[model samples]
Each structure stands twice: as C-alpha cells, then as structure tokens.
Target: MAAWNLYRHRNSDGSSKDWAVRSNSDGSITTRRGKTADSLPGVSNRYGVKQFDIERQKQAKGYVLVGEVDIDVNGNVVFPGKTSATPTQLPEPDANPMSVPAPPVEALYWTVDCHAKQTIRVELGIEVRRLIGVIQSVSDQQSKPEQDWDGWQQFIDATLNAETFELSGQIKSVHGVLPWLFLLALKAKSFKGVEIDIATETARDLSVDLKAEQDVLVFFGTDLDSIRDTAEVLGLLKPRLNLAATMSDTDDCWF
Candidate 1:
C-alpha cells in the first residue's frame, strides 16, 4: 500500500506543480497537490470509478506522470534513491541564495492508438503521415536530410502501419505540431500555424499561441463524444465544442 502515482505539470514560465495519489489500505484513494518541493497536504479522498475519473482530469489539465514514491504508514514520503531515515522536510535556503536551476526537461513519448473500426483513426494516421512526408521533402534539400528522413520513415513503418505507434522527442523538436493539431480540432483560428481565410482560400501567419506537452496518448473512437473525452483530458480539445457533433463536421486528427 506504499505505492503512489506522482504527476507534474510544467508551466510555460518554467515553474512546475506536483500531484500525488495513492490508494489506502481501506480501498480509498488519497491525493496531494502543491508546488514542486512543497510538502503537499492530502487534498481529497475518492473511491472506485471516481478515482480514475479524477486521475484523467488531472492528465487533461497537462499533468504528466513523472515518477512514483512510497508513503510510509507514519505519513512519511520516501523518494527514490533517498534513505528511509532522511527527514521529509527540505532544509531552508540561505538568505542570499542564487537562482535555483530548473530541473532538466525529459523527452516524452507521444502514442496514438490506430487499431479501431472507426475511419477517424485511419484518417488521423494519414494526416500525420502526410505531415511526415512534407518534412521529408523539405529535409531532402538540406545537407543532412538522410538521417532525419530515415528516422521519420521508421516511425511510419513501425507504428502508423500497425496498431499503435509512439513518437519520442521534445515538443519543440516536432515543430509544436501537437498544439497545432489541437488548435485545428478547435477550428477557431488557424491550421498548421497559418491563419485561414475561408473566403479567399489563403493563409497568413497565425495569431494564436498554442501550447501542449510531449507526454500524452491520443485515441480516436467511434464517436465524437468519446474522442472529445480523451481530448479534453489531454487539454487538446476544449469543452465548449458540442459533444453531439459527428466527425464528418469536425477536423480529424489525434495526437
């Protein structure tokens, strides 16, 4: 019963917050939340399906599963690589302390499940593959495109063609495509960083700034309601969209 699921949300300003959840011996779930390094107090208790629902809610809000720790019966949190005897409280900083360094950003894997009967999954796969193809074409003119071309090709061959595929890299490395995809689903302003003029059929520089993380899973199901649920959790799709709308009327792209 010592297991805990730790989650962290990195802010745009380089700060981060933490959330932790663990199941108690009585089959109830407890959760904690606070800024990184703060001793967060247990904030809530949940049971059964509600526990999972809460977890998904946190994920949708951009909290990524960073790591896990152990909480002893005495309410002591035991972090990995630390001695059990160590005090949980961190020591105070000096009066004239230097700026604390930000933690190293870890590369995250983006996974999309394409093994479904719905055509939306296949459409999503095709869209992603098309983007990769464009990347390949652009890189072909560069001095060192062969390596990158081969790598992206492997991604398509390994995962997109099969049931599930995972793409691993920093968010910036993918040219911020995750957020762009989310924005496209919204259909409010832009597509692929371009402002669309429906009347003119032209594109311009996008005005909105989209944000997303590398660690997430995207799955397209049989209906918009299910897809919207998953997207809302990932913070890709907003809640204002009519859940009753079908895929035919909306943009199709996952992750």
Candidate 2:
C-alpha cells in the first residue's frame, strides 16, 4: 500500500483540477493528475527530491493540499475520515470575491510603476491634519479600540516623520509611498482642497495629470493596480472586481 497526498487547484471561474502524488515501495515517486471526476493515470519515472520539487511547483501554481489517502494493491483509494473512494468535489466559485478571506499579511504588497516619476507636496497645516485623520480612521477600523490612537500617533511621529509639518517626496524614488498619496487624493477628490500639489518635472513623468480629480481616478484605476488592496484596507472601498485581471483585459487600450 502507498499513501498519496492529494491537492486541488480551483480557478476563479469555478472550474478545478485535481492532482495526487505518492511514493512507491521501490523508492520511486508516482504522480497523478486530471479533473476531479476523471480516473487519473499515474506516471512514475522520478525519484528522491523530484517529488518534493513537484509538490512545490504545484503549490506555486495555486494548488492546495486536500488530504492524504492510501492506495491499496487492488487500486482502491482509502480516504481519511471517510469510507467513500470518491474524490472530493471542488468548491463552487465565490460570487462575492470579498467574502473569501484576505491573503496572509506577509503576502500583501504595494505595486509600483518603475517608469513613472512625479514630485508630490502636501501642505502641512490642513492637509497633514486631514491625512492624520484618514490614518486614524483606518487604524480605528483595523485596530482594537485601546490601541488605535497610540498606533496612529506612533506611525505618524516615528515612521512618517510628519512632525516637520510638511510632506513631500518623489514618487519614483519611493514608489512604496504612493499608496499614502493616493489615499489623500482619493479622500479629498481634488488636489487643491487637500492642499496637495503634484509636479511632474522628471523625464519619465506620469501620463495622467494628478491635479485633475477625474484623471487621478483614471490613473489610479488603470496604473496603480495594487492600490485597490490599500483602499480596501483604509475602508474607502470594497473588494469587487479583480483589478489585475481587469487591467490585463484593458492593456491594449492603455499601451
């Protein structure tokens, strides 16, 4: 008898495929792959670290471990915690993507456009106050009541160095910081009301005029694909469509 580890990869469109791997008694590894309902054929030509490498490759391709099962000499699958030899069915696609749990925090990342350049300046007196307010609002929504204020203040005082009473930076130089500027622009809906100004002096300047509210939205919509996650974190927006997929669909028009 050989124990097999099963994995399944579900697509956003509700379709899925199943894969299984097991080590043979003779020190070789056998793997099977096919649709959930299909009788998957096994291939066993590799040995040693190849099995582990294949597992990692499948996981990288978005396959998730389902469970372990044993295959007897008679080719019957003994599912753990179940008497049935039938494989588990793939889950239905989520109609509301937001209902799916967020990716691990460590997996979250800010997307930056390496080619774009712009210098943004936010007036200290009014804009910084509003920025702080927005940060506080986000922290309050995300953090516990007892820790929100302190966390917000420490982030402002230590990480941002906003005590200088002004905020200005080159977008290209600090691409990760684009989300903060985007948040400010997103909240105020205009650069003037927030007292935030943008200068595109560099050779590789942004294609959209950041000063214009409509253009700002369009630019963020089409270019800053990952900012949707940040906006969702700030409670300014809800997760709706897959932004990356949407951008890919519109790539021809933009380029």
Each candidate structure's TM-score, on Cα atoms with residue i matched to residue i, is 0.32, 0.32
Q: All models: lDDT?
A: 0.44, 0.46
Q: lDDT score, residue 164, model 1?
A: 37
Worst 10 residues of 2 by lDDT: 107-116
Clash number for each model: 1, 0
The TM-score of predicted model 1 comes to: 0.32
Query: What is residue 184's positional error in candidate 2, in angstroms?
Result: 40
Q: What is candidate 1's lDDT per residue for 6-101, written digit by digit as tens?
A: 777878997776788876778667887767663455576654323444454466456777567765544455667664423224322243657865
Model 2: pairs clashing at backbone N, Cα or C within 3 Å = none
**Which residue ranges in model 2 land beyond 4 Å of their true spot?**
72-76, 87-255
Q: Across residues 1-255, which tens digit of lDDT does each residue of candidate 2 receive?
A: 567887778878987777888866686667777766434554444443235545644664567777787655444556766444654533333445565543322111111111111122223324435656765565454423221122234224422432222223333322233343443444344433232333332111222233343334443333344445555544445567878998888996874
User: Residue 155 of candidate 1: its Cα lDDT?
Assistant: 43
